[model samples]
Target: MSETELPPEPALDAGELDADDRLKPEFVRSVLDAVEEGDTEAAKARVEPLHPADIADLIELTPADLRPALAAALSDRLDGDVLAEMNDWVREELLAALEPHQVADLAAELDTDDAVAIIETLEEEDQRAVLRALDPDDRAAIEEALSYPEESAGRLMQRELIAVPEHWTVGDVIDYLRSDEELSTDFWEIFVVDPAHRPVGTCHLSWLLRTPRVVQVTDVMRREQTLIPVDMDQEEVALRFQKYALISAAVIDAGGRLVGMITVDDVVHIISEEAGEDALLLSGAGDGDINEPVRDSYRSRVRWLVANLFTALVASFIIAQFGAAIEQMVALAVLMPIVASIGGNAGTQTMAIAVRALATNQLTQSNTLRTVRREIVVALLNGATIAVLLGIGAALVFANPQLGVVIAAAMVINVLVAGLAGVLVPVTLERLGQDPAVASSVFVTMVTDSMGFFAFLGLAVASGLVG
Candidate 1:
């Protein structure tokens, strides 16, 4: 079947799918029932109508033990597009079961970027085997892409794009597009290149369709275009696409020659992947994909927990310094956690905002001071609001007015400190060339917890409430 046409899908009842059009429990079970029964035709018929993305989702949603059997049952129906859409862990597992030559064939069917994504996931020896199995041209292209830094424009861009010489008239451009069967079937705009193969301008298909046939391509082309550096980071590329509202941008080599093109579709994936990746990193949760292996998940998460354990000790040590005071007044011990909890939560809120701003280029060197000042004001307001509520509650609950004043003062101090740590930790990490998302949370949590305990307990002792 062609890319657009698949075998007709079996008729599904309205209740067979979820509100989001995802395969519902009953539908998935039905497909699994077919596969379990060794009914290949039934399985194919059931999955035929689903989009490639949905098919990928089905593969992931299936039980891991049954995945291989399901894949075997629907082997002929699975394609590169479906593979591209599958979760990396799920796709990797499936690919591991395929022969090198079979893997190469699947990669050949995908766009270069998607193909690279598949190939890059293979073990080194397996990657070599797959590369050897590929055709020479395909091998060369994938090899070049692999050589580039991972997540760079070279790795994300597609080799296939329409680039016409600037000298071509509207008629000539139209004729070439019509006559060239190998040209990419999907594109919004045609790039106009110089004699040196450097991109000079771009002409939208809509513009070409409306313009007079005699008009020169250069005359009709937009000279101002967002040209992406081939070595630019994928996150930065996504930012440029978002900032400029670009549908597609040309990727150029160090010599300023057009190498490939990154469409908004590719940028969309990058944005999503990066966003999820940062979120996972912030929590030290690793990939956080449901399909992630238990072992991998354990390894990614345990180290963070260990670090948090050490940081927790810092707070414990602070509390120990006020041990006498805490023993004298039980209320101090009881109220300390409330202060720490609120402060940690506040810090997390600020850290999330700072990390996102850094990732999206919303917070930069030019605006860093402004952003920091804005966060401080927000933190102060948040601290005061929480302090008043908590202080009143403490006074009423414990019937200790002196304790209320001490706790209130401590709340404001710790919250302000938490806010500073939140913004500063991420910003400093970024400046030092570290990922703000990865280690910022760890440090921020440590700061908030330690300072919250110190501020609260220390204030109670100093105010004679604990003495």
Candidate 2:
């Protein structure tokens, strides 16, 4: 059907596309049914009016085994924007089904960063075939982007940005933007560059529109601008964008020449991706995507489970050392888990805050000691509050005030230990050039568990509560 002949999309409610929104089950089922019935035209019509992101979601929501069939049903309706919006694994699966030249065609229609994302997923031989099929300029851009480290600014910034000589007038800039059909259509700002192609300033589109025609671009441009280094990590790039409230920024090479530009749209993706990634890493849940293959998920998770098992053994061994004390006073066994549970919870809380702070560059060498001291104070306050409640309850229930005092003291000790372990584990991992999020929880839990058992049981024995 022709574009004009197609039905208009239904108006969506305000929350229709909220961040947490998912495609309706009915809608997903309807589309899948059409695909299953071999009604390609019906499937295409059902999806045609959806946003690219929603289209991507529909694809993801479909069963993975059925996805290739869905893609085939959609056929020509699947485009680069939808592919770009797709989950990485879903996109990889779809891309694998396409021939190299067909993949090249899709890449040709995307910006350099996205095109690189698609191409880099292909095997080396397939990547070569796709590259050979692309236009020379597109091929060169993708090749250069691929050469950069993954998740770096070079691989994230788009090559198609508006950069003009610093001497151009507002009228000239406007005219050039209007006439350059090949230029990127979605830029918010124009970069002012020197003769040697170094970006010197940036002019927002709004500023250009408000200025007189004859005014020089430099006169209207802001000379001070944040420039991203090509090799900068994508997380750092997101941080810079956030810190400066930047809408767009020029990317520079080793020689400080403008190579490309990164827009806030791209940074939005990076920020979300990084935040989710850190959270997943903290749990040792690799990728944590529901659509991840079972074998892949099991492989990633079992290794961490094994490590946790060993850590649990360390806590078990501590309990063994106090087996005699536990036998004499069964109450010690009953109250032991309460101490460890609270301490473990406290440690997890502190670890989460530390990981988030480290991820956002909030916790640094300069403020590390201050953050640590603050957590220690907070831990003491929490420990005191819980200790009083538990102490009174234990004294009343067990009819032994001395037992209450010993347990209270152990509570304070374990909680303080938990606070220290939480901060120290992540900070130490970071110093060793490892991800602070990945294994910090395991180590912190180990410390809290082992120390909680040791402190509680040792004090019980020392206080003569046990034979």
Candidate 3:
């Protein structure tokens, strides 16, 4: 369907497209127009109707210098969610630009995870100031959450939860929930806990409402709860949520006391973060936030590019050794790249699979040898197919049977080596306490390139096909 024919965009207002609903392109044009006309009131009017998240996105989309002006235009509407949704580095700069009272006000409205996320973005002194400005209770809760290791479940979980002792009846649960002045604003399940406050079980809201009020909590609650430990990594939490098909899970502290809770909504964010983080890290790009400052982006990306250059020099050094060989036969120069390209592509395919398997803990020592063998087999079959096609092409192109056979043999050997290096290098790196994903790609590429050149050139030299 055409863009206009598509269902009305949600970002737009009901029955009409408002300035707040304008996406980046439209928003940018409108803001630029306002700036050109020196229309501050017009800009404010255009920005005022956006949701906090939308406003945050709009601010982020604005050029860096214009952020302060945008912030001024939006003023008090820049709430907690907007701050939370802002990229960390951008949030850091923006929080610095905001007053302490403004930062604290936004923090107070956010859930514990989002509040901590924004607070942690501040400079150390600013973090202290923002914390100090918060109410004592909010400050204490946020501080306690910050005490957990960063990116752990404790830090990510919400402090708010619905929990009751196992001895309580369904009626008691209903009454406590109804009468208690303090309860989480959002909860999908009620945790049944021990006297020690350790989660023993959980009951979905549906189960609680449908079961007779007279039923014991134990009778109604499901015993098989996936209680997440506070120290668990957020990625693991997401995995558990996915594996158990859970809507929410209770979180426990070091002593196994119920401390907080995590929901699918939080898990969704964690999953996205972890997945994107791995992708960026694999490319040696730090954070990869679009809103990241240009300098920060350059710093994060250049080191890897430099490292790649050094490695490319190493590959070039290898190629230089065959200068005489290439000079003797122009066909060798033409065909060498073919061999390297094929091997590099093959290695990358396997490296990606291995890295993903390692991340998921599916490629452990128990199955490593088996997986390696299977990959080698697959590589051999693939190599045979490609080599045959290339062999015929080489024979037709160069009109040399020996050259065709030589390239064909080199292709097969290099591809097999490529496949083995793909699995072995990554698995070994992971075992040696290195991140398999980040370093594996570079090493795999190096191996395939070097091996491809060496095998093809070495074979030709051995056969005395070139001198």
Clashes of each: 0, 0, 0
Tens digits of per-residue lDDT for model 1, 60-134: 888888899989988887889999999999999999999999999999998899999999999999999999999
TM per candidate comes to 0.95, 0.95, 0.92
Winner on lDDT between 1 and 3 is 1
Model 2 over residues 248-279: C-alpha lDDT tens digits? 99999999999999999999999999999889
Worst 10 residues of 2 by lDDT: 3-12
Span of ten consecutive residues with least summed lDDT in model 1? 2-11
Q: Candidate 3 versus the native: TM-score?
A: 0.92
Top TM-score model = 1
How far residue 68's Cα lies from its native spot in candidate 3, in Å, is 1.4
List where candidate 1 sits over 4 angstroms from the true fold: 1-22
Candidate 3, residues 1-467, lDDT tens digits: the string is 53212222213221245544465565555754564456667666766666676777777777677777667666656777788777776678778877898889989998888898888766788888889999999999999988999889988988888889999899999999999887877888998889999988999889989989899999988898788999998877888888789999888888999989988998888888888888887778888887777898999889888888887777788889988998999999999999999999999889888988887778999999999999999999999999999998999999998899999999999899999999998999999998887777788888999999999999998998898
* Candidate topping lDDT: 1
Q: What is the C-alpha lDDT of each candidate?
A: 0.90, 0.89, 0.84
